[model samples]
Target: MLGVTSVDLADRRELLDRLEQYYDAVPRSGARVEDFGPLSLFIREGQGWPFYVRPTLGWSGSVSAADVNRVRVRQRELDIPESFEWVAETAPALRAAVEQAGLAVHEHPLMVLGPDVPAPAVPEPADGVVVRTVGPDDLVLPSALAVPHLAFAEPGTGGGAAGLAELGEVVRGRAGDGSVKRAVARILAGLTCVAAAVEDNTAVLGGCAEDASTSGRRIAGARPVAW
Candidate 1:
C-alpha cells in the first residue's frame, strides 16, 4: 500500500480534471444534459439522484447564485431533487452559490488514492472467504447488490440484525426490477465493475466502480483505487 504524502497543486488539479472528464462521460451515456455556462446540469433519462450539476468541462470561472438557480429551477420544474456535486477544493466558489440558492451543503471526505504509482496487491479475504470481481449476470449479483440496502437498513454499527434469510428476501422482492439489465448494460460497456467477497457461495460483502473512464493519460488506479 502507498504511504500518505503531501499532495501538490498540480497533482490535485490533474486528479480533478480526470474526475471531471470521467463524470462528464457518465451522463452522456444515459442522461440528458443542459449546459449553463460555468456548469452542466445532468438529468437522468429515466430516474433521478445520479443526476446533478457540476462545473462545465474546461470551464475556467466559478458559478454564481444565479447560475446555481438556473439549474435549480430546471430541477424543480422537472420535479427532481435539486442537487449539485463537485470537489470543494476544485470549485471553492460554487459552495457560496449553492448556499445562496437556499440549499444545505454537505461535505463528504474524498479518499483519492494517487494513481500514478504501482498498483497495490489485492489483500487476502478473511479465512475461508474468496474475493473476486464478478459480472452483472452472476447468480449472486442480486445478493451483492442487496448488501448496501441491508447495511443501510440498520442504523448503528453494532453489528447487523439481518442474515441470509433477509438477504434472500431482498433479492426476491425486486425480482422484476430492471437493476440486472442496467448492471449488465453498464458492465458490458466497460463502464462498471463489481467486486464480491464470497464465502459459501453467498455475497457477504460487495464493492463497485460505476461509469469509470480509463481513457486518456493513465493516472491509473484499478477498480479499487482512484477517486
Candidate 2:
C-alpha cells in the first residue's frame, strides 16, 4: 500500500508540474515556473522576498545537505537579507537538509480553485474609499498599505542579488506583458481618498502599492499579490 501510494503521489505531482509549466508560459508578469530544482529559483528583487521554491526531483537535481553551504555562500554574494519561501514534500531527508542549513520551514495548506466555481459578487468600497482597475502605469501609488506587500519570506534564505534579481526579472517581465493589474484603494484622514482596481479575478498574478507619507518619503510593499 505504501508503494501504491507513493506511485499515486508521483503521478499527481507530474500532472501538477505540467499544469504549472503551462501557466508559466502564460504571457503575464507573474507567470512563474512553479517547480523544483536548483535552477528553478524565483527571487522577487527590491521587494525583499523569495517568491517560490518547489520540491526537488531526483533526476533534475535536489537541494541537499551538500548544497547548504553553497546556498548560503551565494546568498551573501547577492546581499539578500530576508527569509524566502521553500517547499518540501514529506521527505525527512529533504526537510532535515533544509533545517540543517539553518533555514526555517513552515507548512502551508495548498488551496485549489475549481473551474465550476462562480465568481463572488464584487464588494462595494467602504465609505470614503473607492476601487478601480489599473494597468501597469497606475502602480505608482504611495500609501501605507504598500509596506507589507513583499513580506512573504524572511530574507537571506536564497542567495543574494543574483537570486533577487532573477525574481525581479520575472516580475518585470510580467509587468511588461501588461498581465499585472494594480488596484488602488485609499482612505484619507476622515475622508475617502480613492479606490482603484477593486477586483482581482484571478490568482495568476499579484499587485503592489507604493506608499507616500507626509514626510515625503516613499515605501512599497515587499511583495505583490492580488489579495
lDDT of each: 0.74, 0.39
TM-scores of all candidate predictions against the true structure: 0.78, 0.46
The best candidate by TM-score is: 1
lDDT per residue as tens, model 1, 98-125: 8988889988777676537676797767
Residue-level lDDT tens digits of model 2 in 1-227: 55578778887676455434432322122323323344243444332233444333333545575565454555566554424343343233556667877877777654444347785697765454445533323442322123223323335333233333343444454453322222221222211222233323211223433333322422222123332
Stretches off by above 4 angstroms in model 1 are 1-7, 46-49, 116-123, 152-162, 211-227
Clash count in backbone of candidate 2: 33
